[model samples]
Target: MNVKLILSTFLFGGLIIFNVNALPASLIERDGDTSLGTWQIVGESGVNAMHAFLVSARKVVFVDKLEGNALKRPDGISAISAEYDLDKNEARPLSIYTNTFCSAGAWLGNGTLVEAGGDNGDANFRSGRQTVRVYDQSIGDWYELEGIMPSMRWYPTMLSLPSGNVLVVGGSKAATGINKEAINNPTYTYYPPSGTVMEDYPLQFLAETLPNNLYPMVHVMPNFEGKPIIFLHANQRSISFDLGSGKVVFEYPKLPGAFRNYPLTGTSVILPLSSIDNYNARFMICGGNKAYEITSEGEASCGILDLMAENAEWEMNDFGGTPRVMPDATFLVDGTILFVNGARTGFAGYRKGGGANALWVNENPVLFPVLYDSYAKTFKPLASSIVPRMYHSVSTLVPDGTVLVTGSNPQGGVSLNVKYPTEYRVEIFSPPYLFSNTPRPNIISLQTFEINKERIKVYYQQIVTLIVQVAGGEPSFKASLIHHGFITHSQNMGQRFVWLDVVNVWMDTTVTDQYIVTVLLPPNSNIIAPGPSFIYLMNYDAPAYSGVEVLLNEQPA
Candidate 1:
């Protein structure tokens, strides 16, 4: 757990410090007791949340299907969404004219949430299947852009590229029907329409995946040879696509078992990249079900891939105790993965009749959240939630250490008569790190702050100095830049975490109760893609984070 920073002069102008120590080895193991955290019902969301994203440190926006009866404001406008303030524990209705059902979103470099695609609705004007909406946090309102997507996307995925543009990929052309071979839109296109529309960029792998391929897990990986390569997963197949030239680079081995998209939902995360390994990237996916097994139990299998290897192959692991389908696998600030929500049996969606397990056969919700340690390949159970998060549930890591968990609408509508009724209540889960007795590091100021601009911009390979006040012993600080991607259908697109290197750490001689830490930004855009990321400072304990916008400048100044 002890990390020592070694400074060395390199050919380049800036100092090249190596972080030889591995991430705290203690995080690899866990105690026998499962009660390591606490969960509390924070507030009730007025609308059934189908989609949710963090807008800021203290605010979150929730979107739902445009069912006729939407949450209304005082002026009687149909509010399709609501914004919840974490500080006040209050929810206020935000008017959304479009149907955002099954939509996907990613944050732009300027901190705007660029949401794309949706359901067709009841053939109404508000049906926003091809609409592109942007939510500006400063104004606290939604703006429907004049530009629309080339095709209708129901369960699409969006990822922010290092070039500061959003890439829209893989969704059904229609809204209501199940994902059929003919209805799948396997191609991808950029937002703001990339000039010539290259229709049907033949991705045959998508069609082969069939009904379970909706909302394929996608990640904009580190640039390979200066060209951006995207990793796409549907069913068990993993393929790499070259964004620059728009061609399939290569296809890796199929995942061990079970499909990991839509009805057969599981979850995935791009394992944290470390400087020690030259920032090599790895991807891990866990928990799902067989597509045809409507009432069959979920799978406990997990698959990992080292993308940078010469011949990358998926290594399968089954360390988790119970089976879980549609679970939300989120990466914590301290470089660990957390699995929450989902069911133990059956696939996604609610069944009407035919048997006891029918009418939402996916019962037995996994109450406790499990933590996966990539270092030791172990699983540790954490605190459980009172509310059952099913088909349309979401869990997002907020600026503070706690995770905001909410939403579960198994049935078509909000009906209490069903086995798993619609859920609107929100709960927050605090990890054990948040409850530690160690004093948290306070970031008094950043060296890159400019008086003219409201927010600071930390360029690539830039050395950022922080003035901190540590209450505990000598602080062993680690910086994690995380983008909490769009959470829906057990998939988080563009979600990644990278451990920043600490160049120097020393106590300030002039000031009392203060210290100075110099951290290096990612070397290039390939390591950490450009966009809005939460820079979390982890000292002796898991401390809160502040938002920093990243740009794609590769050259170091």
Candidate 2:
């Protein structure tokens, strides 16, 4: 331990206040070279990024389970959360009083980040099964309220409802290899919950999809008959539930795969929406074990469906010749999907029970990433990484076009010496667009250092003009909005992307290489649920170096 680091940490309020390493050296020297869709090891994280969410363009918040990590709390306990700096590649500790293992989170419509649920913790680790923690990016700390959740949840999915509150669904009481009837918590609840025992609504779909039904996939579909519906996929089944009456409205065709959730996990994402298609949503789920019989090989195919159609059915396709389990599906600014992390064999979770797969459920870390182009309807292999981002790993698309990847611990706790030890490295993947010399657009009008405070507010059926500039010359541009939501367990709950209708674009006489781009916002709140999101400009297929944050239907604070 560096003596300077010890001097940085001292007893304050009977707790240890650990300051920043300020400039911890990265194991790899980032030459700042543009490899074009390459991976770069930037820095290490204070906590394993089992769960993470981008707080701002320059900052990310990483949370893990109460394991034996290297960073400690103000009280000399293992730190399970930290604020990661994307610009300086530095990490600073954030105070978290509860266990966040296998938890769920979402950004409220008001732009507050809320976290919920976790498993029982050790003596030092407080029970987080029913806690709710909200993050203030400005303060860089978590304010937790224990026993606030209606139920004890371990792997529930947290999604933002149309009304601005978060809906936490699914998960179990205990950490079981596969869900069992006794421990299965097949229900959903709200953040500022209704004051009643009946606040937690029962969802029979969860109980029916037993065994491998942890972190059940749920996405808010477009409004149907003036009410919102959520699509839930678990095991091999999929269904649409009406939020108004709490009933399964439609049963879509079943997905053809072994299991799409934990223990053998794949990943799912809602494709980019556009007015040309009336914002008709299409969802895709890719990579997992193909069948129950095959445990060592991952599912080589993907399933997609037009979820809002009257006669919706799943269409399957190959996973670009790659087999993956626990892969992270991230939506990029250029309307392409990037699948990274996970392994080629086995399931999620670490070595547990007595079995051949007990040593580590997963194997052969899928080092290479696959890119899915929705327009071309094809998958392409991209550059590979030297690290194995297997179980508990997560990848997040930052404000910058690059993807920040972190975490991979296949153990009960932090272990340094193992085939796949707990990983603290934070790497960035630059997409191929960055490598090309193609001109990229910059959102010059979006000038804000503060988060939602300075965000451009978009309402229903509104048209907004963004001043975009390109160095090479004036070029055609398109607009898109992405809300990455909370990234964990490959779900990235509440994550959505929409194509903003570019009504008009014309060169600006006042500024060279600058254009006034007018874009039509989503027609209604259903098109983009209320919350903080990112607005991106694309010069053909190349996205701007970074995106600017915007508030979608977020009321004044």
Each model's TM-score?
A: 0.89, 0.90
Top candidate on TM-score is: 2
At residue 537, what lDDT does model 1 achieve?
74
Give per-model CA RMSD: 5.0, 11.4
Looking at candidate 2, what is the lDDT of residue 125? 70
Please, what are the lDDT tens digits per residue for candidate 1 over residues 412-433? 6666555676787899998888
Task: At residue 323, give the lDDT of candidate 1.
Answer: 92
Model 2, span 1-557: residue lDDT tens: 11111122211111112222222222234455545378889999999998999887778899999888888888898789999988799888888878898999998887889999887767887889988899976677899888877778998898888778888899998877778999999998888765643268899999999887899898888763457788898988889898779999888887876578887788898888876666788989888775443257988889889987888888889889878888999988888999999888888877664333456678889998988999899888888899999988999898878899999998888887677889999999988876555566677774323333456666656667676777654354667888988898777888898877766666666677676666666766677778888888776556776788877783345
Error of 2 at 527 (Å): 1.7
**Which window of 10 residues has the lowest lDDT sum in candidate 2?**
1-10
Q: Return the clash pairs for model 1, or none.
A: 351-359, 351-360
